[model samples]
Target: MFYLTVDILGTISFAISGVLVAMDKKLDVFGVFIIAFVTAVGGGTLRDILIGNTPVGWMQDPIYVFVIFGAVIFGILFRKRLKYFRKSLFLFDTIGIGLYTMVGVEKGLSAGLLPIMCIALGTMTASFGGVIRDILCNEIPVIFRKEIYATACILGGASYFLLRKLPIEDIYAYIGAILIVIGIRLFAVVFKVSLPNIYKVEQ
Candidate 1:
C-alpha cells in the first residue's frame, strides 16, 4: 500500500512538472499531455527494461496513465495559481525524485541487486524522466547540469540501505530516506549550492 502510494505521488509530481514545462514552451494540448505522460513514466519504464521487468511498468498498470492524464488537466486548470507559487516546478520535481528514488531502490532490492547497483537504479529512476522531458522540450537536462539533482537520490538511497541495517522498521526507513532526498534538494536550491565549476573561465 505504502509503495503504491509513493509511486502514485511520484507520478503526479512528475506529470505536473512536465505540464508546466510544456505549457511554458507554448505547446498545444496534445503536446502537453504527451510531455506529462513521458515525464511521469519514462524513468520507471527505462528502469524496468534494464532490470528485465517485461512489458514495463506503466503498460502493466493503467493507473499510471490515468494519473498522468488527471495531473495534466489539474496543472492546466491551476496554471495561474501555480505561476504565483514561482517554485512550483522545482517543488514537484524534487518531490518526484524523492519518491521515485525509493521506488527504484525497492524494486532493485526485490530483484536481489547489490546495494551499489540499487543506488544507481534509484538515481536513474529519479532522473531519466526529467531528462526525456528536457530533451523533448529542447532544453538541457537538469541531471546534466552541476545541480544537486541525482546526487540527492544517491545519498538518499545510501541512507535507506544504512537505515535498514539498524533496528528501525522498513516503513520508517523508507519515509526517512525520501525526506532526506527532498531536504537535500531544498537546501541546495535555497542556498544556491551546486557542484564546483569544471570549465576554465575565459581570461
Candidate 2:
C-alpha cells in the first residue's frame, strides 16, 4: 500500500515534468509522447536492471504504460494549462522521488543487495527518468544540475534504511522516510537551494 502510493505519485509527477519540457521544446505530439514515456519509465528501468530483474517492471504491469500514456493524453489536451501544471508537476515530482526511493530500497533489500547499492538503486529509481528525458530532449537533466533532486532521493532512501530499524510499524516507517525525502526536495525548491557549478573546474 505504501509502495503503491509513492509509485503513482512519482509517475504522475515525472509525467508532468516530461510534458512541460516537451511544450518548452515545441515538440510534436509524437515527440511529446516519447518524452513522456522515457521520463516515466527511465528510473524504474534502471532500478530493475541493477537488481537483475529480468523483463523489468512495466513489462509485468501494463498498467504502468497506460498510466504514462494517460498523462500524455492529458498534457496534449491541456497544454495551455501549462501555467497551472507547474505546481502540480513539482508536487508530484517531489512525492514521486520519495515514493520511488522507498520502493527502490525495498526492491534492493529483497534482491539481497548491499545497503550502499540499495541507496544507489533508490536514487536511480527516483531520478533516472528525468535524466533520460532531459538527455533525449537536448536539455540538462534536473538530477545533474542540483536543486537537491537526486539528493532528495538519496536522503529519502537512506532515511528509510535507517528508520526501518526503529520500533515503528513498516507503513509508518515507510511514509516517514518518504516524507523526509519529499520535504527536503520541496524545501530545496522553495528556498531556491542549488549546488554550486563545477564546470569552472573542467578546464
Candidate 3:
C-alpha cells in the first residue's frame, strides 16, 4: 500500500512536470499527453526491463496510466496558477525524483541487489524519466549537467541504507531518505551549488 502510494505520487509529479514543459514548448494536446506519459513512466519502464521484470510496471498496472492522464488534465486546467508559481516545473521534478528514487531503491531491495547496485538503480529510476522528457523536448537532460541531480539520489539512497541499520521503522527511513533527496536538490538549486566544472574557459 505504501509503495503504491509513493509510486502514484511520483507519477503525478513527473506527469505534471512533463505537462509544464510541453506547454512551455507550445505543444499540441496530444504532444502534451505523450510527454506526460513518457516522463511519468520512462524511468520505471527502463528499470523494470533492466531487472528482467517483463512487461514493465506501468503496463501491469493501469492505475499509473489513469493517474498520469489525470495529472495531465490537472496541469492543463491549472496552468495559469502553475505559471504563477513560476518554479512549478522545478518543484514537481524535484519531488518526482525524490519519491521515485526510493521506489527504485525498494524495488532493488526486493530484488536482493547489493547496496551499490541498489543505489545505482535508485539514481537511474529517479533520472531516466527526465532524461527522456528532456530529449524529447530537445533540452539537455539535467542528469547530464554539472548540477547535483543524480548525486542527490545517490546520497539519499545511501542514507536509506544507513537509516535501515538504525532502530527506526522502514516507513520512517523511507520518508527520511526521500526528504534528504528533495532537500539536497532544493539546497543545490537555491544556493547555486553544483559540481566542479572541468572545462577550461577560453580567455
Candidate 4:
C-alpha cells in the first residue's frame, strides 16, 4: 500500500519534471516521452539492480510504466497551467525526493540492509534518475549544485530510521521522513541554503 502510493507520486513527479525540462529544450512529443521515461525509471532501475532484485521493480510492476505515460500526457496537456515551471519543479522535486527516499529505505530494511546502506539506497532512489536524465540531456543536474537536495533525502532517511527505532509506528515514521525532507528542501530554497563546494576551493 505504501509502496503503491510512493510509486505513483514518484512517477508523476519525475514525469512532470522531465516534461518541464523537455519543454525548456523545445522537444517534440517523442523526445518528451523519452525524457520522461528516463527521469521516471532511471533511479529505481539502478537501485533494483544494485540490490539484486531480479527483473527490476518497474519491470515487474507494469502500472508504473502506464503511470509515467499518463503523467507525461497530462504534463503536456496542462503545460500552460503549469506556467511557473521553476515553482512546479521545486514543489514536485521536493515531493518526489520525500516519497522516493522513504520507499527506498523501506525496501532496504525489508532486504535486511544496514542503516548506512539504506541511507545510500534512499539517496540513489531519490536522485540518481535525475542525475541520469541530466547527463543524457547534456547538462549538469540541478541537485548537484543547487539547494539542499540529495542531502535532504539522505538526512531524512537517517531520521526515519532513528524515529522508527523509537515508539513511532511505520506510517508515522514515513510521514516524519517525508515532512523532514520537504521542510529541509523548502527551507534551503527559501533561504538560499547550500552545501560547501569542495572542488572550488583554492588550489
Top lDDT hit? 1
Lowest lDDT sum, 10 consecutive residues, model 4, at: 83-92
Global lDDT for candidate 3? 0.87
Q: Which is superior by lDDT, 2 or 3?
A: 3
Q: Write the per-residue lDDT of candidate 3 for residues 1-203, one digit (tens) a residue.
A: 86566667778888888898899899999999999998889988888988988889888878988999999998899988886755766776787789889988988988999999899899989988889999999999867777899999999999999999999999899999999999999999899899865564433
TM-score of each: 0.88, 0.91, 0.86, 0.88
lDDT of 4: 0.84
Question: Candidates ranked by lDDT, best first?
Answer: 1, 3, 4, 2
**How would the candidate models be sorted by TM-score, starting from the highest?**
2, 1, 4, 3
Scored against the true structure, residue 20 in model 3 reaches a CA lDDT of: 86
Model 3 worst lDDT window (10 residues): 194-203
Q: Residue 95 error for model 4, in Å?
A: 2.1
Task: lDDT for model 2, please.
Answer: 0.83
Off by over 4 Å in 2: 1-6, 199-203
Which is superior by TM-score, 3 or 4?
4
Error of 3 at 28 (Å): 2.4
Which number leads on TM-score?
2
Candidate 1 Cα outliers beyond 4 Å, as residue runs: 1-3, 85-92, 200-203
lDDT of 4 by residue, 1-203 (tens): 86577557768888888888888888899998888888988887888899998799888878888998998888999889876665766676788788888878878888899999988888899888888888877888977876688999988998988888888688898899988988998898889889978776755
Cα error, candidate 1, residue 32 (Å): 1.3
The window of 10 residues in a row where model 1 has the poorest summed lDDT is 194-203
- The residue ranges of model 3 lying beyond 4 angstroms of the native Cα positions read 1-6, 85-92, 200-203
